[model samples]
Target: MKTYDEKHIKNVVLVGSAKSGKTTLAETMLFEAGLINRRGTVEDKSTISDYHEIEHERGNSVYATSLHTEWRDYKINLIDTPGLDDFIGEVASSIRVCDTAVMLLNAQYGVEVGTELLWDYIDRYQKPTIIAVNQLDSDKANFSQTIEEAKKFFGPAVTVMQYPLNAGLNFNCIIDLLKMTMYKFPAEGGKPEKLPIPDSEKGTADQLHNELVEKAAENDERLMELYFEKGNLDEDELREGLKIGMMKHQVFPVFCLAAKKDMGSGRLMGFIDNVAPSSVDMPAELLENGKEAPCDPKGPTRLFIFKTLVEPHLGKLSFFKVISGEVSVGQEFTNEKTSTVERLNQLFIADGKNRNAVDKLKAGDIGCTLKLKNSYTNHTLNFKGASGSIAPIKFPHPKVRVAIIARNKQDDEKLSEVLSEIHMEDPTIEVEYNRELKQVILHGQGELHLSLTKWRLENIYKMQVEFIKARIPYRETIQKAANSSYRHKKQSGGAGQFGEVFMKIEPYFDGMAPLKEFPVRDTETHELAWGGKLVFNNCIVGGVIDARFIPSILKGVMEKMHEGPLTGSYVRDIRVSVYDGKMHPVDSNDISFKIAGMMAFKEAFHQAEPQLLEPVYDVETTVPDEMMGDVMTELQSRRSIITGMDNRSGFQVIKSRTPLAELDKYFSVLRNISQGRAKVSIEFAEYAPVPGELQRKLTEEHQKELATESH
Candidate 1:
């Protein structure tokens, strides 16, 4: 393989909704460049991008695959990303490293929910994007409507460069506005013959051409002046103007394609090679220290690991892009994040499952190295003296959660190891062993994301696992004030344990009045690790209880707070005042005071109105207008409180606050109600009180479990 400099290397990521023909487009581009002997279809599971076994089983892509093609004078590295939002981690990482994004729009569906969902990520990075309207040969294809929807969602930056003369079932000819020519393809559809624009369509073609010219000229003052002087720009000038517009995100040129039939792919690739911004042309990458790293081959070597994969035979492949200088085989670099030295023993350009070994990779080129000791995804490798590392990719938080249990009892440790490996490969899948819940929980994007993880664990790791219901992290607190005293007197052999504690427990808030009955001597406010505050008031008078033993009393209160009387949940937002207590001079110690204080707090908690609090999430569900009512009904049925509603780009956004307990398998239910036309996002809002009946049932369940355990 030949090495290309920054100017000649273009890193592009293909992103769009599922069934938008992104994988098909990638396969067609490779075939057109003669990198592949024949094209592969998704139906046959032969495409280069959708190469995973799970993808084959699901008939869709789940992982982002990397492939490269050398066209004309440039090397276009393509990162084909999965379209489902569940796999959005792949798309986000790809977008972070790529210089350009090629978003495919399926003509039959126009702009879909997935398209709208992904546009947020693309717009966040402000990546130079190209819009490719694919599947024009489908019977239901509507090119004009798709373009209209794209403009509606993406704003006025959408610029049409080409449109099919006959979009549906016979999309063989396309009118190119930039060149003022027509491309006519044969029935077999490999290459096209250029011809003059037809006289009948000249008026529409000229009008669109003038609009395209004005759009391009708007990005540069020099191009605007030249266009006004000559009434038009030359081919090279137009390419230059469009490139400027792309870099500024002021223009998104649209093209037509039928990737399955191999029509218009050649022209799209030609445009990418000729007009798209290469890595060197893009803005310098931002570093952690607010500095920029220019793509200069002569600078110090730096590489950013964007993705990691573990194949069955191949141990680990860390895919990275050369950020500054060139890297060759056997070159050593320090992992900035881990402070470990790693040598690039072998470098290869990845093409799906296949890899072509290369001696050197220059700046802006994407390649993978094998067997790095400490480096992983989002880590940066730099020379020893380099100061700052590249800014890491921020993956989205997990929206769905499930408790995982190993079916075989002996495989518990192995299950943990497998989950760790999975998280290393995909950071979006988070694993936590919650001590309070006593369950190993797996958090991910959605149900599909977690089920796929289960599939991998069972098939790849050969471990049987089951996903159970994850318990909610509920909290317990008091709603009123109550006073109680407990006497702990026991004699175990030599020393007798005798201690008595008198305390008052009251509901706590940010600013509350102090106790007026007892003279306040000293006050201590403690912040609980779980949530809320534990205000401990030492109101004892005249050293009735020693100052040293105050901590012991507070510790006892905390012991009861940790395992609340009801449901064994953490207690928060409460104040306990140790006003008076009696201690046996010899027998009273830390343990005795702790017991007495714990018993008093528990007795007072039972007398006071104890309330159960569950986590609430702010959920935003984007639903189509036709299915808005159904989605709204579904949310209301789950004890959700409607917060607000918004209208955006032909979709309705329903915002609500729902309890965490009511949101189990919520996405699955939403998908079923909307027929997969709705998208939802959830975030922790605040903790709210649970209903009386539900609280009673939960407390009873906890007591029964404790009773059974006592046996």
Candidate 2:
């Protein structure tokens, strides 16, 4: 309802481990800002941030919620994101557009696995961050210990800005080193009474204050010179220095807060309003042409969609950050990625699930609009024929996969439509129709992620679906060369079918010349659909077989390649030369030659020592040093070859090469082994030969399946 300039706007995101009171802190902030009359708790599932039904059922945030508050004339756009790493896309989207990130640490547990995982993205974006060690009222709260861990994990930049005098139970009083005053909040938790530091705690407070001053001054040259001359920085100078330090990621100020009780939030808000860097202070955004564009309201209109949510009644709610210029309602802009013009029919700033309609969104601000065709998350909307677009976000790859099918076959068609909608909302849920595997595979972060997807399908879409381990796409290739011939002669009635084919097969390699032992006219090559190459060198000598029947022969060979004879898998990497063949004048039709070529290729493939190639993955796992031995031992048992090991900040990163077949449901096993303190990412590597013993077993299983089908 009020207009704010870029200098008065602050885009912030609250991120940390689960149950760290981020949602409660947001609720308290909204309440204090006069946006809400009352604060809602997570136990009742009535908090503004965790308003979704699934979030209520899970008692935690499952998606990011957008909300804003006006604190002391500054508009703070706060996005509360999910703490579960499974839904990291939400966190990533929030970080992409935010100017600052407030990382909440649970005082009891200190730095956790989730916190460590989130640091990578925060570092990637290089956003200015503040550490708020929360839940100081709990019995297990250990502010000192938590700060020590934070410094150890996050580095020396985690400087102290506040210290709790009495943390647990009696956590109302805190000494603010930034302002050099002690704040004592009432038991009711409204406003705090600022008082001078007591004589008993003056020495400790002064020491901490000096450390804060030094940390701030070290980030800026002017401040460093002033500090060396005057022995300290004034209040205004300290804030200016801190702002510079924050933007450069040279300092991470830690504050104390009992968020649920609404203590210490007022001080935090004050700091954000007075010192946090604005969009103008940030570096210029890089465009598609590698040109930096400043945040100028007079420049071309550009908005980057960071997140998208599709509701029951609301079609598509797109959350975007205006990168340049002002966009009034009904203004049309070109979708840089799609090259299509889209009009913003209406613009609204998100308030949880509700919207506050705005006439215009200015540069360096976050807002949302609905129902834009041909636009989704990560798409940048700019003026027509603009020079460039904003870079796209790189989402993490899915770590777990399952083949899904509709329980009720009628819902199968509906399943695809709903899946597309889900994918639009959450890119982490990968749904693919793998023709080679003959199944639709759903890839997600872990089992919980897929379980939630199934729930949504059953409850929201009214569809029945089943999740099963996806079949690995194995390959079949040959090891040696062989020549074989077959004659297909079928005579039952008056007419007869007769054709003979002689083919020499050898393993194909890139840049190798096709077999030219005999004179040939045409050389046809086909790239196999899955992988490798297929070359047919027509070495038929003279007029042994008709040239017209050559395609038919190649087609027959492809049919066998589509479903290999050894294990029913796709075949690749082989050169076939039809050096010799026999055909009858009246009986040698396309069918006869095709059958003869298929039979001859199968015979030669079996004789050439056909081998099975299993898909392998390059896996990287980061675990605590105490659990590294256990994790490596477990991985070895799963037939994983350890590639390398490196150490990082009390953690171990182990890289390995493991077969995909051995990785089915491996995420759960990895988590269990490390007690949820480990993270893993797997990517497809080159296919390797299956072990001889496993190959024999797989062949036997294939034969049994064939026999059952025949019966």
Candidate 3:
């Protein structure tokens, strides 16, 4: 493969909501560019983007696919990403490596939930973006309504660069506003015909043409003055102004296309060639050491791995963007994060699953390296003595968790190793072993994510695993205060043991109260002593117990405080005062006092008001306006409190706080209610007390389970 200069390369990512025809648009683009002989359909499972077995079976993109096409003297690297919320991490990673994002909006549905989500991510990354209204030939397609929705969601920056010549089923041509020419399709349909504006569309065409020209003029001072003086700008002047506006992200040009029918794609290619920013025009900032380095191809080599893919057969492939300097095959660079030197044996430009090896890669280019042992996602690579490392993109924490148990004992030992490898491939996944529960828990964005991880374990690692529904980590606490004491008397053949402990137990202020009455005072001459004076200053001033044994008595009380009376769980935020005790010099030891202390704590904790605390999550969901009421009611039924609601273009955003325990199967439930139109994001919220009746039932159940396990 020949290496293209920065000016001839276009790195673009295709992003949108699920079922928005992003993959199909990519297929059409590739076909039109002459990169492929035939166009592959999603239903036929032969598309170039959805190459994975899982994606083929599910008919959705499970990962980002990279493909390159040559159009108008440029090599366009197109990345097609998943649209589902569960796989958003893939889209985010793709965006980090691409210079521009092409947001595909369903012409029939207008702006959907995922489209809004992808827009937010694109804005966060500050990437240049363009909108493609796809599926224009489908039934119920309304270009005007879709454009209105786009304007409402994306602001007034959205400008129409191309107008559809016809509506649904009749959509065969597109009129270029800048060129002021109509490209009409023949009734027999092969290539498009460049002709003068149709008589019927002359008025609307002229109006749209003037709007485009004015908008373009506003982007350039020279053009703006010319338009003010002459009442219009030439085609070349208008195109130049539009290009400048697009590069600055001041305008988001909208184009219409029927990706499946191969309509209006040729003109879209023209826009990409003329309007998109070249690598030289919009160079990426480089960071060497820690400070900003010049984005010079002649500088020291610097690249950061933005993503990694582990194929069962193809080893590990690391995709990265060069920040500073240039790299050629066989050149060694230091990985600043790991402090290890790695040599690039082979560098390639990835096209879907196909990799074309290149001898060298320059700055501002996205390429891949094969089998770099120490390289991982977000790791920076630079020359030795580089200043600081590049900052990595932030990923959201996994809110949903589940326990994974191997189907058999043999697979148990291999589970951890397999999961670790999986986590390395997708950093968004978190795998941990819960020591207290003795289970391996996998956390992800939602149930589908977890399920996919499990599926990978079985297919990729060849390990069969069973998923166990996770139990909430509930805690018990005392409600009221009570005072009690116990006596520990033990007689052995050699020595007799006798000790008495009197402890007053009270509810501590949620671990915030300071230790009371046990103040330590130090003078210049006094050394720290183990035993202290035991006085009941609340009543009689006289010592209630021997001062020597006070330390021993307190030791016993401390041990009991750790072991809760009801459950064996650790007790916290409670005050225990060792006001009175009796000790024998010979027989009364730390052991006897500790036993007495345990008995006293058991008596006091039962008397206090005890309750259970459960974890809650703050959930945000986006659904169609018609289904908002149903979703809200369902959340309420699950003990959720709606916090706020707002209309976002075509969808409704609902924010609520819900207990995690009540949301076990919420993913399936939400899908069922909204026909898979809703997407939710959750984060850990504060823990609150369980209801009285529920607390009682939980306590009883815990006791019964503990007893049965003991037997």
| Candidate that would win on lDDT | 1
Q: Tens-digit lDDT track for model 2 on 10-57? A: 999999988888999999999889999999999998888888788888
State model 1's lDDT: 0.91
Clashing pairs in 3: 66-352, 289-387, 289-388, 290-388, 479-609, 479-610, 480-608, 480-609
Considering summed lDDT, which 10 consecutive residues are worst modelled in model 3?
523-532
lDDT of 3 by residue, 117-220 (tens): 67777887777788999887877888899899989988888988887878687777888787878877764343688988788888998898888887888888
- With candidate 2 superimposed using the best TM-score fit, by how many Å does residue 531's alpha carbon deviate from the native? 3.2
Order of models, best TM-score first: 1, 3, 2
Model 2 residue runs over 4 Å out of place are 186-190, 199-204, 332-334, 338-345, 383-388, 490-498, 506-529, 533-552, 575-578, 584-594, 624-637, 642-647, 652-654, 669-675, 700-711
- In order of listing, the candidates' clash counts read 0, 0, 8
Ranked by lDDT, top first: 1, 2, 3
